[model samples]
Target chain A: MIRFDQVSKRYASGNDALSQISFELQQGEMAFLTGRSGAGKSTLLRLITRMESPSQGQVIVAGRNLNRLTRRQVAWHRRQIGVVFQDHQLLFDRDVFENVALPLKVSGYSKSHTERRVRAALDKVGLLGKEKMRPGALSGGEQQRVGIARAVVHRPAILLADEPTGNLDPLLSRDIFGLFEEFNQVGVCVLIASHDLGLVASRRRRIITLEQGRLIENREQRADVGPG
Target chain B: MSARDRKTASERSRTLPQHSGGGLLSAHLEVLGDSLRRFAAAPLSSAMTIFVIAIALLLPALLGLVADNLAGLGGNFQDSARITLFLTGQTDDGEAVALSEDLRSAADVASVSYTSRSQALAEFQAGSGLGGIVTELGDNPLPASLSVTPSNREPDAVQALVTRLQALPQVESVLVDLLWIQRLDAMQAVVNQLGRILALVLGLAVLFIVGNSIRTGIEQRQREIEVVRLVGGTAGYIARPFLYSGLLLGLFGATLACLLLMALQLAVSGPIDNLLSLYGAEFRIRFFTAVDALSLLAIGSLLGWSGAAISSLTRIYASPP
Candidate 1:
C-alpha cells in the first residue's frame, strides 16, 4: 500500500519535480502511471522506494513514512518491494541465473532456496532455458524478462517497474504487461510507469496520469471509448 | 485472487522457507569468496597492491632482524669485560692469594684466577718477543694479579665492582676498560631506536597502501554498489567484499615479505659465516620465529581492516537519498 499526502519534490537546481501531489493505492491493487517525459512519474515511484525524499508533506509506503526511515531501515524497507529499471541493470559479469538470484542472495536466502526460487521466477518469465546465458547474449525482450524475473524472485509484496517495455515492440510490451498481471493476480501490488498509452489503456485497470508534476487523472479505465 | 493462485503462492512460501542459518559466519565466508573471485578477475592490479604491501612490511622486518643480530654481537663484547687487579709490590704472595680467595666469594665476581709473579713474568716474556732483553734486565718486575670476571654484565654493576676492588688495601691499581663496552651499548640503543622508527613509518605505509587499494576498488564498483544498496543491502553488507579484499591483500603480502626476508638471509648467510669465522665469532643471522610471523600477520591484517573500514564507512555515509 502507498499514500502520498500533498507531497512535493524540489531538486537542488531550482526545479520542482513533484508538486503537492496526493494519491493512494490499496493493498493488492494494480495501477499504471502514464505521462510525458519529465512528468514526475519516475519521481513518484522513486519517492515510494525512498530513493528521493519529498521536499514537503509525506510519502508513505507499506505504512512507514519515507522521511522517518533511518539509513539502515531504508535498506530493510526495500526488501518488501521490488523494482525493474528500463536499462535492465544486470551485471554483465554474471549470468541470467545470478542476476535473478541477487535479491535472494542479499536477503540471505540459502543456496538451495536461491536456486529453486531463481528457476521458478525464470520459468514464469519464459526464460527458464536461458538461465546460464549472459545478458549480452540475450535479445532486448529476453533481457527485460530477466529484469522482471529478478524483480519478483524474492516474491516482494509490491512491484514497481519503470518503462520496462520501453525498448520492445507492441507485442513484447503486451507480454510484459501480462507478466505484471500474473503477479498482481497473486495478491502482489503492482505500479508501472510508462508512456505507451495504447498498451496501458487496453488493460482496463486503474490509470493515474500526471502532467508537469501534477496528478491530472486518478480513475480506472472503462470498456467504452470516450472523446479522443 | 483465484484459489489456484493462492495455492501456488502458499506453496512457494513453503518451498522457500526463511533462511534459518543466516549467521554472521556464513556471511563472512560468502563475502570472502566473492572478494577472491573479484581479485582473480583483475590479477595485475591485485598483484601490484600485494607487492607494495609486501615490500613495505619487509623493510621493518629486516631491520628488526638486523638490530637483533647487532645486539647479539654487542653481547659478545660484554663477555670479555673482565677486571685485572695487580697487587702492590709490598704485598706478599700470601696476601695476594688471600685477596684472590676473597674475590672468589664476592657476590659480583663470577670467577677469580691467580697468577703468581714468576708465572706472570714467564707469560709476558713468552708473548712479548723480548725474552733476551728481559733476561738482560735480571730482576723480574711483573706483579702478581687476579683476573676477576663479574657475574652481571650490566655497566652499573660492573662499574660498582671495579670501584669496590679499587678500594682494597692490598690492590695497587685496577684495570677496567669499560669505555668501549659503554660505546657498544650506546650503539645498540641507537640501532634499536632506528628499528622502532622504521617500523612505525612502514606500518603507516602499509595502512596507506591498503586504503588506496580499497578506494580504487570502491570507485570501480560504484554502479554495483548503488544497485546493491537499492536491493536492501546495508552498508556493512555492501562493504563486506571490499573488507575481505583488504584482508587477503595484507595476508598474502605478509607471507610474501616473510619469504623474501628468508631468501635474502639465505643468499647472504654463507658470506656472513665466513666473515664471522675471520673474527673468531660464532654468530649467524636468524629469521623470523613463529611468534614474530604470527604478530606480523596480525598487524598487517589489522591495518588493512581499519583502512577498508574507514573508506567504506565514509563512502556509505557520504551518499544518501
Candidate 2:
C-alpha cells in the first residue's frame, strides 16, 4: 500500500517538481502514472523509495511514514520495495545472474535460496538462458528484463518502475508491461510511471496523470473492459 | 490485499533465511576471497603497496634488533666489573691472603683473590713490556692487592661496596673499574629509546599508507558501491571487502618484512661473529623469536584493519545513499 497526502517537491533551482499532490492506492492494486517528461513521476516514486524526501507532505508505504525513517531504517525500508529504473542500473562487470541476485544477496539469503529465486525471476522475465551473459552482451530489451528480474528477485511486497519501457520497442514495451501485470496478479502492489499513452490506455488499469507539477487527472480502472 | 494476506506477506518476510553464525562466518570468508581476487586483478599495484609497507616495517624491526644486540653486548661488559683493593706497605703476603679469605665470606663479594707483592710485580713486568726496567730497579714497587668480584653489578650498589671496602685498615686504595661499562649501558639505553620512537613514527606511516590504498580502492569501486547501496546493502556490507583488502596488505607486508630481517641478519652475522672473535668475546646474532614474529604480524594486520575501517566507514557514511 502507498499513500501520498498533500505531497509537494521543490528543487533547489527554483522549480516546483510536484505541487499539492494527494493519492491513495489500496493493497494489491496496480496503477500507471502518466505525464509528460519532468512531471514529477520519478519524484513521486523516489519519495516512496525514500531516495528523496517530500518537501512538504507525508508519503507512506506499507504503513510507515517516509519522512521519519533514519538512514539505517531507510535501507531496511527500501528492502520491502522493488524499483526498476529506465537505465536497468546493472553492474556491467558481472553477468545477468549476478545482477539479478543483487537484491537477494543484500537480503542475506542462503546461497541455494538465492540461486532458486534468481532463476525463477529470470525465468519469469524470459532471461533464464542468458544468466551467464554479461549485461553488456545483452540487447536493450534483454537488459530491461534483467532489471525487472532483479527488482522482483527478493519478492518485495511493492514494485515501482520509472520509465521502464523508455528505450524499448513497442513489442518489448508490451512485454515489459505484461511482466508488471503478472507481478500485480501475485498480490504485489505495482506503480509504473510511463508516458506511453496508447499502451497504458489499452491496459485498462487505473491511470493518474500529471501536468506541470499538478495532478490534472485521477482515472480509475474501468471494469467494463478486460485485459487487452 | 486483505488483512490475512498482509499478515502472510509479513510472515513470509520474517521467514526469510536469517544469517546464522555459520552464515556470518561464510560471509566473512567470501569477502576475504573477494579481496584476494581484487589483489590478483591488480597484482603490480598491490605488490608495490605491500613492498612499501614491508620496507617501512623493516626499518623499525631492524633498529630494534640492533638495540637488542647492543643490550646483549652491554650485559657482557657489565659482568666484567671488578674492584681492586691495594694493601699497605706494612701488610705481608700472609696478612694479604688472610684478609682475602676473610673478604670471601662477605655476601656482596662473589670471589676474592689475593696477589702477593712479588707476584704483582711479576705480572706487571710480564704484561707491561717493562721486565728489563723492573729488574734494573733496586726494589719491586708493586703492592699486594685483593681483586673483589661483586654479585651485584648495579652502579649504585657497586659504589656502595667500594665505599665499604675503603674503610679496611690494611687497604691503601680501592679502585672500581666500571666507568667504560657504565657508559656502554647508558648508550644502550639511548639506542633502545630511539628504537621505540622510530617504531611509533613508522607505525603511523604504515597506517596512512594502508588508508590511502583503501581510499583508492573505494574510489575505483564507486559504481559498484552505489548499486549495492541502492539495493539495500548496509554500509558495513559495502566496506567488508575493503577492510579485508587492508588486512591482507598488512599481513603480507609484515611477512615480507620478517623475511627481509632474517636475510639481513644472515648476511651480516658471519662478519659480526668474526669481529667479536677478534675481541675475544663469544656472541651470536639473535633473530626474532616466535613471539616477536607473532607480534609483528598482529600489529601489521591491526594497523591495516584500522586504516581501512577509518577510510571506508567515513566515505560510506559521508556519501548520500
Candidate 3:
C-alpha cells in the first residue's frame, strides 16, 4: 500500500512541483494517473520511491515514512517496487536476460535462482525466447514488453509505470495495457501516469487527474465511449 | 501483501541490480569489481594506463629503497666509527696508556688504542708526506692521542664523548671529525622531505588517471546506467561498474610498477654491486617483500576506490526519474 498525505515537493529553485497532494493506493488496486506534462504525476511516483523528499508532508510506501528512511533504506525499499519507464530503459550492453536479472542479482539471489526468475518474468511478457538477445536487438513494443517483464519480474506489491506505452504503436499499446491488466488480475497494484486521456478513460478504472501540481479529479471506474 | 507468497522466484528477482554488497553494505566491492572487470577487459589500454600509474608510484617506492640502502651503508660506516682522545704535552706515556685501559670499560667506548708521543711522531713522519720537514724541525708538535672508537657514529653520541674527553685533566681539547656524517644525515633528511612531497603529488596523479578512465567508461555506459536506475537500482548499484574500473586501473598500474622496479634493480644491481666491491663492501639492492606487495595492492585498490567515488557520483546522479 502507498499513501501520500498533504505531500508537497518544492524544488531548490522555489518551484513547488506538487502542492498538498493527498492520495492512497490500496493493495491490488490498479489506477491511471492522468495529467499534462509537469503536472505532478511523475512527482507523485518519485515521492513514493523517496527519490525526492516531500517538502511539507509524509509520503508512506511499504509502511515506512519517506522522510524517515535513510538514503540507504530508501534504496532498499525501491528494490521491492518495479518501475517501467517511457523510454523502456534497458541496458544495451547487457543482454535481455541480464538486464531483467539485474534486480534479482542486487537482491543477493544465487545464479541458479536468478536465471529461473529472469526466465519466468520474460515469459510473462511473451519474451521467453528473447532472453539471450540485447535491448538493441528488440523492436519498440518488444522493448517496452521487456521493461514490463522487468517491472513485474520482482513481483513487487506495487508497480509504477510512467508512460510505458508512449513509444509503442496502438496495437502494441493495447497489448501492453492488456499485459498490465493480466498482472493486475493477479493482485499487483499498478499505477500508470500518462497524458493519453483516451487510453486512461478507456481503461474503465479509477482516474486521478492532476492540473498544475494539484489533483483536479478522482473519478469512478467508467469506460469512455468511442474508444477501441 | 499475501500476493508475494504466491510469487515465483523470477517475479521476485526483477528489481535487483548486480551490485548487492549486503543489507548493511552499500555494495562498494560490487562497484569495485565491475570497475576492475571493465578495465581488465581492455588489456592494451589498461596496460598502458597501469604502466603510467606504475611509473608514477615506482619513483617514491624506488626512492624509499635507495634511501634504505643509504641507511644500510651509513650503519656500516658507523661500525667503523671512531673518536680520537688527545693527551696534553706534559702527560706521561704511562698515564696515557692507563687512561686508555680505564676508558675501554666505559659504556660508550667500543675500543681504545694508546698512542704515545714517540709512536705518534714516528707514524706522522712516515705518512705526512712532510717527514723531511718534520725531522729538520727536531721537535714533534703532535701531542699523544688515544684513538677512540665507539659502537655508533650518531652526532649526539660523538658530541657526548667529546664533552667527556675534554673534561679530562691530562687530556688536550677533544676533536671530532663527524662533520661529513652530519652532512650525510642532513642530505638524507632532505631526501625524506622530497620523497613525501613526491608521493603526495603522484597520489593525486594516480587519482586523475583512474578518474579520467572512469569518466570515459561512464560516458560509454551512460544509457545502461540510466537503465539500471530506472529498474529501481540504487546509486550504489549504478556506480559499481565504475568503481571496478578504477580498481582495475590501480591494480594493473601497481603490477606494472613492480615489474619496472624489478627491471631497474636487475639493470643496476650487478654494476652497483661491482662498484661497491671497490669500496670493500658486498652490497645489493633490497626488493620489496611480501608485506610491501600487499601494501602496494591495498594502496592501488584505495586509489581506484577514490576515483570511482568521485567519478561515479555525478554520473549516477544524472539518471532520470
Query: What overall lDDT, based on C-alpha atoms, would model 3 receive against the true structure?
Result: 0.78
Q: Which tens-of-lDDT digit does each residue in A12-129 have in candidate 3?
A: 9998899988888777789999889989888888888666788998987756687887656766677778888898777787789977877776566656666788889998888899
Off by over 4 Å in 3: A8-17, A36-38, A222-227, B1-33, B40-49, B85-93, B114-145, B166-176, B208-226, B234-236, B282-291, B310-321
Which candidate model has the greater TM-score, 1 or 3?
A: 1
* Native contacts, share recovered per candidate: 0.40, 0.38, 0.28
Q: How would you encode candidate 1's per-residue C-alpha lDDT over B1-321 as one tens digit per residue?
A: 366456435533432425547534566787888889988999999899889898988888888887888788778778888999988998888888888888899899999999888999899889998888878889988888889999999998999999999999888899987888888788878878988998899888887888888999999888888778877887878888888888888898898888887788789888888888998876555656878788788877887887788777788888883
User: How much lDDT does each candidate structure score?
Assistant: 0.85, 0.87, 0.78
Q: What is the DockQ of each candidate?
A: 0.41, 0.46, 0.29
Tell me the TM-score of each prediction against the true structure: 0.90, 0.90, 0.82
By DockQ, is 2 or 3 better? 2
Best by lDDT: 2
* Residue-wise C-alpha lDDT for candidate 2, range B1-321, written one tens digit per residue: 478457646834752536666556767887898899889999999999999999988888888888898888877776778899999999998888889989899899899988888898889988999899998996988889999999888877888899999999999999876677778778888988988998999889988999999999999998889778777888878888999999999999999998888788788878888898899986665667777778888988998998899999999888765
Residue pairs with colliding backbones in model 1 are none
